[model samples]
Target: MKTIALTVATAALGTDAFADSSLPGMTGTDHVGFTVPSVDEAVTFSQDVIGCNVFYPLGPFSGGDSTWMADHLNVDAKAEIPTMQLVRCGYGANFEIFEYTAPDQDTKLPRNSDIGGHHIAFYTTDMDGAVSYLQDKGIEVLGNPTTMTDGPSAGETWVYFLAPWGMQLELVSYPDGKAYEAEYDERLWDPRP
Candidate 1:
């Protein structure tokens, strides 16, 4: 069992396994897709609060009499997408916001501890001002901004908040860069322009 566990860990880490095989002509991420309870409401918040620019909107698609939805999107065959739109915020990856309808749809927002749970983090130079702005807009700011003063994350500050639909969002700032920057050549994607 120990040997099997080690093998699995090595495979997951990809230390040497499948080193040569990679996606051809691959580049950095272009966009991140997520479904929201209401596309219009999501777009409004993204635009009015987050300052995102909404791009072209897509159609209300259905699978009809086929299993195209299940086969292609891995969703229920009868699932439908009522509305979808692409949004660009700052210099990070664009967002593909979707509104889906299905018989088995789950409306509850998952906690960060749950599998497949996620949040969109925005970078800001003024963490305090951003938190105050959210509060002024009646947005739910989870707690005070946490500043990491030690370890690799030193010089970083972050706080989580919630969207009107209960989706998780975060504000992160590291104006002077994190401590890890000095120890490594490669760095995480910087949102600063």
Candidate 2:
């Protein structure tokens, strides 16, 4: 694990990059979308265990055998995105899950070091109870919970776990708040109850 350092200078936004005019009064995250091997299983896990509620379902969408989708979404134009479901995951952003049948789709889960590899982390009030519950339900927890010893994340405890389909997930808890939060007037949204 790496200890991320945050300083006033490091936190300043850089002005050298090409900047588009910001969207006026822009809101926060709308959703985080990801492709899944099976949307049905993803939905079941999210709803039954993760406590998300289905927003809606969409698709069987294609680009009508043309290059429209290839140019826009970078998918094969003839590919079929069989299903898409939006689900609200607690007080955080929604998840847009997809099931696609494409000519060049890769089903293997990527390592965190691989480009675009990522994991979704949920905050909890009790790390031990949460880990125990997931284990009893047969989910693969990678290791025991680790408590951060220093830096902004000190006092936090977290552990990585795997979904049934092998997509990585994490559970973190810091009921007393993190070291960095004390410096800010407003804190970021925490999933803890």
Candidate 3:
């Protein structure tokens, strides 16, 4: 597997990204978090549009209102912390939704290059076919599905796309999974209590 260059950030601290996650039974690191504007809207898109399942619901009592943690615990009684909806891919992998009560403006994940937040990847048995279905639904396809001829994912194929609110997603078909294995390492994403 050929190594592809991935950017690594330098600063480190007890920020939200640095907060020690109390996710149960997890010993490795958590990669990223997704911040959205509304839990209800996020639920609609993820369930109706993305074809995922609700794994768990997150409220401030559970995960805390960082960005996706919408209403402050004291601000909105029902919304003590922001509400988080965890959605699962058809195959079983999960992506979480975080909708904080922020302005409906683009904050960080505007371009495809921001490397801090979460980017959910869905595994599709057929790559091109999946891309066509999404595009037909009026979703924004980020160019074409590129079959990697270089790097560890050399034989793997990926097509990038964005959710209506600008959350990034990927449709992927791996002819061989060596690259993904190396990258993800079978890491369990949810460990928080």
Residue-level lDDT of model 1, residues 1-193, one tens digit each, is: 5345646865785655435548754434789999999999999999999999989999799999899999999999999998999999977788999999998888888888899989999999889999999999999999899999999999999999999999999999999999999999767767765
C-alpha positional error of residue 97 in candidate 2 after TM-score superposition, expressed in Å: 0.6
TM-score of 2: 0.84
Tell me which of candidates 1 and 3 scores higher on lDDT.
1
lDDT of 3 at 115: 55
For 27-145, candidate 2 gives per-residue lDDT tens digits of: 34679998889999999999988788988999978888688888988888877888999998766788999998888888898989999889999888879999999999899999899
Candidate 3, 105-144: lDDT as tens digits: 3456655555555567777877878888898989999998
lDDT of 3 at 3: 13
Worst 10 residues of 1 by lDDT: 18-27
Clashes of each: 0, 0, 9
lDDT of 1 at 157: 98
Model 3 residue 72 lDDT score = 32
What lDDT is obtained when candidate 2 is compared to the true structure? 0.83
Pairs of residues at least 3 apart in sequence or in different chains that clash in candidate 3: 23-191, 23-192, 24-191, 60-81, 68-98, 69-82, 70-82, 70-100, 73-80
Q: At residue 117, what lDDT does model 2 achieve? A: 89
